[model samples]
Target: MPSSTSRRTVIKTGAVFLALGVTSCTGVPAPSPSSPSTSTPSAGDGPSAAFTFGTASQPLGLDPALSSDVESYRITRQILEGLVGVDQTTGKPTPLLATEWTESDEGRSYTFKLRSGVIFHDGTPFNADAVCANFNRWFAFPAALRQQAPGSSFKGVFKAHSDEASLSIFKSCTAVSADTVRIDLTQRFTAFLQALTLPAFAMASPAALAAGTADVLNQVRGGQPLSAFATNPVGTGPFSLGTWDDASVTLVSNKDYWGERGQIATINFLTYDHPQTRLQALLDGKIDGFDAVTVGNFDQLVKRGMQIVQRDPFSVMYVGINQEVPVLQDVKVRQAIEMAIDKDTLIRKFFIDNTAQASQFVPPKISGFNNEAPSLGHDPAKAKTYLEESGYNGEELKFYYPLNATRPYLPTPEKVYAEISRQLTAVGLNIKPVPVDWSDGYLQKVQSPGDHALHLLGWNGAYADADNFVGPLFGEKNGEFGYQDPQVFSKINRARSMPQGQERDEQYHTINVQIAASVPAVPIAFPISALALSDRVANYPASPVLNEVFTKVQLKP
Candidate 1:
């Protein structure tokens, strides 16, 4: 995860596009005019062509505000437009529908100038009023919606403006001008600009949202509406929903899109529950791309002529110790457990070379990463001594691990947990392994912390920020770990308050040091993502952000 300043610098440096090579992949020989071609047709062609792709799982919803998962956000990216959009070449936020923006000195008030002549998929005009109406619906949802909605990941993060008479009618946030809106925050946030790049901030046209005489956007709150427009989305994006077959979704290109017309005129997204089936489909040329490649078949795919794209995703795979448990409450015991395991050996055996051994909770890709922090290296003798000192006798401990086959970008969770259990038994600790299905197990563990003595878990960074790495894990009232440190919170708060400069850097450095000393979550390894793509697909870029923008993709002849 990169800091705001680092992200800005990266954007200014233009290294992202240079490293990836932004030139469109063309020049391939076109097939015969009468032959079947995978590429979509242009406007010149009497009937535009469509492209199809495959994924491991189905998307949860089409509504941008209701989406939180990767698949849902990927689909939302095609149907919604935000004020600022992420650059495909770089992860930095750039002006999109909004032509320009200005911020007050205090950074509390921001005004945006909307681009002219934008229309929704339903032929509705998109303007400042539309933006306000969309935000109003989003801000109206309660905290419970986070669990109910498909993409309500950051539901409680922002508080809308309250006084409607003094300001705008769009919930808590107010609109100042026809093309400008003023967003007043409850507190100063350094990552607000980056947050705006997320799908939750997408703009929706009021006319389109209210077209069917049903409150589709507000249906999650239990309103008396039998018909909702969310199922049939209306947006100013490149694609419009065509057919939803429960197992697959079809999208057609929006002819009236305001920007450069997309190369592909249509897209068919097919979802499969099993990774093996998806991989087989990709290899057989039945689909263009698939994710969550299994470790066993990764090498086989490469041998069979498949393109593998790798990236360091923002996830920390670690063993969470139940601090409330009497055996794990002691700091010495925790340190002993950390030292007992050989992380490097585990990485070498279970993961490829690309997977890095983690010494701290935050991955090295994140900004303000502390390379010099003291790490707990493998030393079984020291671990034994600490265990003896803590008066640990032979006692049995039950460890819970999910039996999920596909967990975002990881392999089978049960296999990883079994290896861990074997390693723990090698030491004096008596271990019992319990495997449960992912869906029920994941919800139970996250909702009720400390359900097990130790469990395997992962965390993905919401944005490229150190605050994202720290605030959610250790902050009071957040995560399963109820650990609170005023000094740590103060340091993070200082970093958030300071402008982009040396002071902010110094504050982050302090927070990192504090976190290293007080290990709330033990960092194990930063795994690398492996994506399988067919030769027909072109211009796919690898990114840590994990955003999906396939409009530029062109299929082969």
Candidate 2:
């Protein structure tokens, strides 16, 4: 995550466009398009008083363990704190609830020294025992429960790979002392630290757990949250829940906060599913800020004198190809589809300013982005040749996409899909659009084998690591996207085990290059994301990780 100083540097250089080579992806010289520029508020400007933010969607729930989508994550971070936090500038693990930690036994064991004098929002003491209890509960959550509630994104990282003992890497969490907890792993997993930063690993109040707040079994069977957990979340952050419902979420400041208290007394996150409505709310001064600003509205917002903060590229919009489907199973067919779409034209036609066409899975800031990787060019003739070689006989590929959900990476899903569908048909492949409401587990359906042939999805780095992208998308054979390429899988594993250095980076580069050749998915673009703020808002934290902290935010008098 970039700090305020570095963020300002990026703004001055228009680095979002330069870093990803946004305009140069096609290897064809085209006139440079105008991109979104950034500026720092002089502290004398922006909204005054409590911050009220409107978003395009609502969180499924506030429990960190049960929320996976970005809307949920944005709210969850305010209510929970993990054992580890991220350094704003470096995007590396730093101490949070846990003051310090040490690794031993060749990285198989980790002991964390908990910060003292901390208490949950419910007034329960936070101790090593609480940490152990939270860990045990996560490990004990039924795998069946995970299927019913796809929000448990931690399943990929925590659940055993197989029934075989050796295949699983998780061991146990034990309280070594009143202020220390030790976690044991079955192996030396290099991405363990990165994994800890995920919301699933966040520490919740043990008292709430004891009260049966997170009833995973009941939640799985009934599709209803245990009201205690859902309605009244308990965490050790700088805010406590004020009110929560489907329409709006309100958080009040924690006056007795252990860390610095937030400047604003309250934050109201109102759900505005319509992009235009949400933007209008900000424009009309009904709200102070919002994210996922409507496309083609930057100039309008700038004209309105709004304070816009654009993040450096840290996400990838892509098409997920399910290999289990017959036609898609053909590597040539997959490559043909990948080569058919013109990403450059799509960006210009549909995307907002500064979004770059992606050639590989991870973004430029991530460790493994290969500058020398081959670009998947838009060539209709080449696409046709590949389709002919594969002997595809006009089978209708079920191309699934979501409706009513606007994400930072894929803001206009329907339009983007339409463009891609048009390109695929022009290349002689039959295309069928299967549109579903995004809230109806659209992403899960695509990731599930045989349910989809081609689907549109995207990822913003959960933590600023390459492993965060590869491990979730392609680690296990049954991982997300259901993409099975033996060479790609093997190379990814080899890359995951190596430490962060030249050797690890080289291995990752090799793996990315291999994935491109495999055509498991079409890497679309690294989107330039922004947040709209009112004139009187100041020090509104702009995080590269998109995990904005609200404690330091201020409002003019």
TM-score per candidate, in order?
0.79, 0.88
In candidate 2 the C-alpha lDDT for residue 105 amounts to: 82
Q: Where does candidate 2 clash, by residue pair? A: 46-535, 46-536, 46-537, 47-536, 47-537
User: Each candidate: RMSD to true structure?
Assistant: 8.7, 8.4
Candidate 2 minimal-lDDT segment of 10 residues: 22-31
lDDT of each: 0.62, 0.73
lDDT of 2: 0.73
Ten-residue segment with the worst summed lDDT in candidate 1? 21-30
lDDT of 2 by residue, 347-451 (tens): 887666667888888788676779987776999999999998996999888899988888888887888899999999999988889998776667567665555
Error of 2 at 408 (Å): 1.1
For residues 1-557, what per-residue lDDT tens digits would candidate 1 score against the true structure? 22234222211222353233212111112122232321334556522656677765555456666545466567777888788765556455566777666666466656677767788887877777787787776665554444344235343234222332232212245677776666655455666666677776777667766774323345431121122565667788878888876578888878777665556778888876676787888878788887666665565675676776655556667777666656776777777777777887766655534578877666675565677766778888887888889856756666777653354435556667777777676667777776755533343454344546677776655456666666556543333444557788667655654565556656776777777666665677877655777877665655565556666665566
Instruction: Give the top-scoring candidate (lDDT).
Output: 2
